[model samples]
Target chain A: MTGTVWDRGEPRLAGPDTALRAELRTAAQHASGNVPVAVATDTAGQVLEGMRGRAFDSAAVVAVLDGDRLRGLVTLERLLAAPAATPLGEIMDDAPPVVAPSTAQERAAWLAVQHAEPTLAVVDDAGRFAGLVAAPTLLGVLLEEHDEDMARLGGFLGTAATARSSTTEPVLRRLSHRLPWLLLGLAGALLAAVIVGSFEEQLGQEVLIAYFVPGVVYMADAVGTQTEALVIRGLSLGIGVRRIAVREVVTGVLLGAFLGGLALPLVWALWGRADVAVAVALALLAASSIASLIALALPWLFHRFGKDPAFGSGPLATVIQDVLTVAIYLLVATAVVL
Target chain B: MTGTVWDRGEPRLAGPDTALRAELRTAAQHASGNVPVAVATDTAGQVLEGMRGRAFDSAAVVAVLDGDRLRGLVTLERLLAAPAATPLGEIMDDAPPVVAPSTAQERAAWLAVQHAEPTLAVVDDAGRFAGLVAAPTLLGVLLEEHDEDMARLGGFLGTAATARSSTTEPVLRRLSHRLPWLLLGLAGALLAAVIVGSFEEQLGQEVLIAYFVPGVVYMADAVGTQTEALVIRGLSLGIGVRRIAVREVVTGVLLGAFLGGLALPLVWALWGRADVAVAVALALLAASSIASLIALALPWLFHRFGKDPAFGSGPLATVIQDVLTVAIYLLVATAVVL
Candidate 1:
């Protein structure tokens, strides 16, 4: 329960545990069926008399059904305002949104919110009434999904599983949860060293070339992280990667040019080496442009594979940017300065 | 609306724009006053009659008002099942959760969700009923706030404001939104170079020292980012930084030791230099521990200042960790290798 709380909430509708292709049937399990219901032909007097004999869970809305098929819905307020002799059909909202059990849970929630309905009707494949997803459950799912997205982007493996437990979980459990990504980071760090070692001759000839290694990598990472954040969020909001691809590429190049343009003068003034400054500027330009593309592509690729797009963000992306930036900086430096 | 789309909703009750110190009065703006009301002495029939005459904004529940004082709340479902002659005072929920106008909006939302109430009642400082915040508005605010948190953590300067526009924003607008942070990153990159420049002698004496710069800094940033994400999220969930401080410190040390342990033998095996390997390991240990502390402290400090805790995450935290990591690596390298 401590490590796997999300699975307890109705597997398919629950946020973090939801598969990439989860549907409304999974979410319907979380819906509350404990509501008042009446036959579509029932009059207000008959419904009121039946209601008096039965205990209700949440009486926010009363469903009017024809056999097992949902016919209409009557909000408690509307029901109360109706005269006793009025038939339920005369006052019920005949067009309340109904979702098939196979609909995507996110789409279902979106539709519910857009219609300003506190509850959503879930119907079976044959259009029979299934149940209602109450406002509280939808709110919980939305909030849980938000947390899961952030956790995935943050690159913590078990952190999403233990999200609620993070605050009060024991220290050992916290350590255990965060260690998986840090271990992956270790492998990336080693690869970064191997990449730098490939340019050892350049470093030996001009030691100053090594000084800007962190600078170039950090800038590239800064730019990349921004794009990854944007892309991940955009994907969740239903915007496709192709829509923002061109603008991001242009921004990346422009950002690179502007940042590199400023750094050229600064490096030249500080180091008194024109070749080194040129190398730094060119590397920055290359790294920035490459980082943005990588950031955009990684998330898009993950999504294309039916994975959470957030899986492509955070430490994994940062390490990839770092290795590339170092290789780019050293290669450009060796060519220009050595 | 182009830049300040968030303001289109009520200023105070909306999510992202709320200041850290914001109180209940702001959230009350989202509350609807269009509910059936009775003087507590009125019967269900009178309340029902009154409800039918008005155009209600939200009819989830009825507020029993006794001379502007919130006497009790009668949910629509409860009212429907009650006999017409039952007095409002006898059938209403006498102790529904009520908050003063100064209650924090987030707290109010939490209370509403916890109580499974579709709306929240806000009372003034002197206990007069302000209004009832409907479910739709609260749900919208929560989702908006969640998006803002993610945007801030992702390091895009105007991304939170332009969240909905990220996919569709023009190239220039995207550049403008991202440049402010990248500019700050540029400054930090320059400082990282300066820090590396200060270690010129050690790097010149042994060029291999420069090879691990990116590796060490990258690892530190990776570690720091995990802490930053955790601290930012924890703060938002009302978990105080001090509560998790000790565990985080210990976790950082353990993680550093583990990563450094694995790294030491690898560096020695690849480079065949024990001094260099030892320096790398020790530097990793020191940098990792320091990065974790900085990550935890920055977000806590930002939150304490009534600023968004997310401001302490992303590129800002990463850059700060980079500077310290580089400084720590070189200082240890100079001591061990030279």
Candidate 2:
């Protein structure tokens, strides 16, 4: 009778001022309309029953009491739903859910669900009920919140360009969408092979470099990723400062040391030369330590600067780490093997 | 009287039922404290008087209406704050905010706010007022919520490593904690300059390459990120399989076209050389588009494989994008410049 329930499947009230026993009348009206409801107070039960199964007159008054105030609401359905013999002392709720009158319509909708309420009782400074907010208003608010979250994410990444052309594709149609491009990796290696063919004299003299390439590349990547993983996790969790600074840093050092130590023996076995082993060990230790730090720092920086922390996590880290890793490897190779 | 408010400003409901109303007292003895609340019917004046100047009893009850089964609840502080002259009808907020029984205790603490009325109400189905959840219980729940949110974020990111050391300074410790990091893009750029110093010779030989460096690296990064972002967002939001694959791929293609056009002109201006511009333009266009599409595809693959989308977002994007960008650039340069 109040209205349809698109708002959150909750009932609605007219406003703050109903005459005494207003609730009772509201219930009776509903019952006449074929919906049964339990009246809260024993005081209002009889008047509702008196007109049992009959349509309630809107102007008809009913005697009622709920806790301390008198309400003008009365409905036949409410009367039918209540236990016929229950005492008035046993049937009323104490406090009702409410919101401020000035509350945004959208926010009000979310509150109904998050706060788990039916009608949002509007109130004033002294906590007096001013009016009621319907459920549909609250639903609108929830949808708006969702939209805002999406917007922030879109802006942080480059969504506009992506949306424009390949509005249907995943991101952008570039070298990757086609199978021809997948062969590019093979192409790069094939080119590398051709380049080495021209430098056959040098490569033949230093054939061991090939064995070191995979380890060096993989190690650099692993260290970089491990660090990135840590930093991103820290920012998202709101981890305490103490842990981020002290504990996280200590962990990076320990991990670097472990990795450095593990790779030293392998490097020595591969080249069987002290110079090569020392260079590999030193590079591994230094790069691992630095990469871990950068990974952690990058995310923290992004979060601190209001940049997208996720942005700090992936491509940037790899760009800096890989480039540096490759350069470091080349430098050490020059220092030792050359 | 119940306990006073806590530091965080939430009302405190202390141990056990004492000084509570009759319905609450009865439910406590009979319902074994499992029920949500108890109800009673009275005038607004009586309801106010019962709650006036005194805290609601610890064993307070949630309330509902016998009239139309509307819900309302009260709490101890609300009762104490209630004005004697106020009518219950104007203040009865039938639907009190409620939480799941299993909610964290810490979060529950702050959640207990009494706009009006005395006794936090707890209720169950069939429109019955069970018993009060009590302020103290809620406070405990609130504490638990904070911890839970932290743990959940960690799990979502899917890692537990906290960085303990860095190759250089602990960037998060030195900077992130005090403020944000991305805002210092200038500083990040300067730091990048220091990194580039280690490879200045390589950069100077092909200054044209320098102009295209940012454009190339960023474009590849943008493409990869766009793809990942869309796929991840879709999976998280629970998009259908068809929608994700079709929508994301199309989006990537569009994004690539837009970026490629911009990069082509920029590289042409920077290099001022016909062949270099054409080669760089082709490379940028291809890499940008492909990187984005690949990035987009990975998220769906991750979901299909039951891996996290955000997991590989950072390190993976950087590596694939950088390697391809660098290799392509070098190859294209060889094909044209040489």
Candidate 3:
């Protein structure tokens, strides 16, 4: 039920080793070569007869080959729409999006999605036609990629393995999958404590300073998360980080100003401390703007370091945001409230 | 570049109204009825001839109809593999997953993914065939749904509207989109401050108690976020909340115990205060466990209310976790140290 239930072409079994490796080629498998093929000179009538004589597994798109080299592709829809006497060359999409057989499965799926094609043609290094990746295989790749991204963002140990595992997979397995990030978070937590401890004198001067620590950190994290989500999805959809940098930063500052404005009055009304309110408002403005910038920069940094952008989304980014927020909040409290 | 580049059947122009509404029929555009459909009584050979006469935009799946009454579907793959003399009735998939035209677009996409089908047949109330939803349409829907889910989790204003807008969308527009959640977060932040203020008497008794507030809150939020990601993806994959509830809870507790165990000694060593250490560790364990429960329950509650489960993921969950983490940390610190 784990893998075969959604079997398009690959039988993805739920096992410990099902974790997709970082290699782009790991996702691409050899196609069955069962799709219908025709020579460039074949007439629609001749292609129709050839199609009838053979038991091809998929003929959604007929590959037009010149001996071993693919020249073009003709969707079955086009073939059916054409007069039987028309030559295949006249109706074929001559410039179909072709990819190397070793291309990352995710990229291959993206190419198909970008072109809105249900089938993709794979070519070998020498420009020889390998086979067609059917719609199901492409769909499976898309779904798997989606799961992997979500898993990375969730801080799972291995996305493909854990996502495939039944809910009842061993507790030990769950622990092993989750502990790495939680441990990283633990280190961040300790650092937060130390940072808070450094401001002990300031905190002692004004007990109200501690009241807003969690609030500021949470808000920064929230703002940062929105940026992370946008950047991750945008990068995948072909929008580069450099394209939206200015707009995102400006949005961050504006968001800070608006949220801080609302927060200032509420804190003052509730606490009756003008200094504390000012400190809270200042911290909010600073932390929020910084959080948005960090959110955009981290994913871009991960991408530059040859990592998935999602690697920067979860605990790692949140920890950094928390530390900065804590420092900003306390420093402002020291200057304004103390 | 609007729709032709992605050439999925619909030409999705980048517009302010692209956010998919809650209706399913919005995504179900009229299929050009140009796909090669046939009556169940027609022979494959006859259907092939009939297909040659019409201009089909897609023939990946041939609808077997009886005077507009939907009979079954025969994939082009299977048709290619069958003897041409065979009748459509003998080769058709009789039990295709059919949805009403009004079914939610996301749900329709899910049904297609779960069934591993490339084409979906939309049937009317009396079971009359509307038309075929081709593979490109299904792929588009999946990608859109993916974007929308990510946007909601990231706390975006309107997924379709904002995600499609170039990151260069006006700062005012960006502010408008983000301010709603940030505003919601501001209210939560003020409430957190008030919660902390109520415990000021206890905090004054031990100044060191304030150091762990941000750390504790940050760690619980990290854990809760992991759970929220899993539950959101899990629910979409057809895993019911009840099935994984117990396992998730146990995993959360075990995570809490392990992290808290490590943190206890570390805090004690750093601060030379066993009482403070014990208080921090106890709060971590309790808050971590509670965080997981809240994470799971919030999405479930939203799902129960007929809302998108992702609505429970970002700021709302974080805000709730923050308030509770602050309360628990201070209460534990007061009990242990004071």
Candidate 4:
């Protein structure tokens, strides 16, 4: 049981597991390899004496190792409370939460929070103790991830620093960070204009049909935004769109039916045009149902391509939802009013 | 020198500081009063022995107090490293990060992260020691705030739990959380329709004006959404909207001019209608410039009223911006194109 060697170099790998090391950014990258370690057979007093003059990245928890393999973990409090001769093996938590080095940082941090652990242990593919991610590092990661998500969702060009500096940033720098998305949105807006213009003759025949274009487009966009928020957040927490698609789409349709049902009578009462009202209601139902699909699919596609799902929730998704909504609304209106 | 009182009740106040304690929900509410405490003159050996059988909410940092007043702080590692007979005062950090008990939880957490402290000390108004907010509690607070911001920005009725459960929640429960905002959006959309209908005569004369409605509205919404994201995030980090307003509005106006200049020539080339193109470009300029103002103002107002600034970024802001954008676009078109 006293086979542990106090080596500070990288954990010696038993085999080359390239697939597990392929992730460019992972828990291993941020973990510190300088935490305290001891053998299971060491008594509490012995470990404490060993730690006295040694430097460690974190001493909140001590890792018990067999050669290079991680065996168990014991918090400092537990060690200090035990009798001087108590063996670490008898006092250690055998089932401490552990993650592979390849795990995503966000997922690792989430696991630490779930387990209420102050530190996270990274185990390599061969079960060797790699390092520990201390609480401060995890806190920084959570804050950084939150800022990145906000920037992406807010249509910045994937710059987390912008969230803090945008308020004080030079106008030119601010414009540069924000213009790419707005330009793409400009292109999308022009495309929506072209789509709406193709139906100019229909609009000229009965002008009331044009009145609901913004209303229908806004509803679809609103519904899609809610779904995008959910899907993006879910993806970050390791929940895939595939797992949520069925329920979300159902919720979208149900929302559509409810809004459309309310809109039909309300439009009839206010606008005094039954056909136009019917068209608006039908378009609401179709546009909203499709909005959910587009919202779910875009994030899923981005995630599949190894991009942040947050990128899918920006102006790009809104533009897509807007154009489709316009086409669906007009098509429904044309069929109903003509 | 062992004059420390080991009372576990609330810190004995020296005077009534009711004004400082008036906040309904603050750091004091979540702070644990069960943390370890010691006096400056106590020896490290004596303190360690005293902590042997104690049950503390957190022992990561010991609060040094003089009667009820907090004096300094010392980490457990430092205590362990000091010679057994060394006075705690000689080893303690004279300055530790502290917050008034009435401080906002987010701000307190931010300070903790800024100082790289594993724990936060809460000092009551009479300079009395309240307790410590441990690392785990701060982690929980940051995650909760992130969820709440996402839900509010996503238009989910201020429910942070919706972020996690929206994927698995029943359709009815999902709808209940989401529909209130959508319904408000519907009302605003209808109001926009009515506003656009008011310009029906102008639209009938030059039907092209109606084609650019969604384009103008979308661009304004996009711009406003960016500003809202920045301001709301800034507000959470304790930066007031007033501090960000000037630069943000300038950025908005600059964004508008750039987009408007680009659109002018493009719309003219595509539609070949000089007056209609001018109206679209001008409306883009005015709507975007105004979008920044409304976006900045709404969040600031909500924050001033003691509500989360995130509440202002949802459908409520979108609807306001949409209606105003439509009216401005159509009004400009009525003057230029009609």
Best by lDDT: 4
Q: How well is candidate 1 docked (DockQ)?
A: 0.42
The C-alpha stretches of model 3 lying farther than 4 A from their native spots are A1-22, A25-43, A55-57, A63-72, A88-111, A121-132, A160-172, B1-43, B63-73, B87-104, B107-111, B121-132, B160-170
**Could you report the Cα RMSD, in angstroms, for every candidate shown?**
7.7, 17.3, 7.5, 3.0
Q: In TM-score terms, which candidate is top? A: 4
Deviation of model 4 at A226, angstroms = 0.6
A-chain TM-score of every model: 0.76, 0.44, 0.82, 0.93
lDDT of each: 0.75, 0.40, 0.76, 0.82
- Evaluated at residue A107, the lDDT of candidate 4 is 76
Q: Which residue pairs collide, candidate 3?
A: B34-B56
Worst 10 residues of 1 chain A by lDDT: A1-10
**In candidate 3, what are the lDDT values of residues B1-338, reduced to their tens digit?**
01000112332222233334342234345343445667777777777666664566677878887776778888876776677788889999899978766556666766776688888877766676667777777766666667667777788764436354635577787777777888788888878888888988887777899888888998898888878888887776557788888988998898899888999999999999999999989999999899999999998998777667878887788889889989898888899999
TM-score of each: 0.82, 0.41, 0.84, 0.93
TM-score-better candidate, 2 vs 4: 4
lDDT of 1 by residue, B81-198 (tens): 6887788899888888787655545556666766777677877767777777766666666666666677777777734364557657888878877888888998899899999999
Error of 1 at B254 (Å): 2.8
Cα lDDT of model 1 by residue, A51-72, tens digit:
5423344556677888778898
DockQ per candidate, 2 decimals: 0.42, 0.04, 0.49, 0.62
Candidate 1 residue A282 C-alpha distance from true site, Å:
2.4
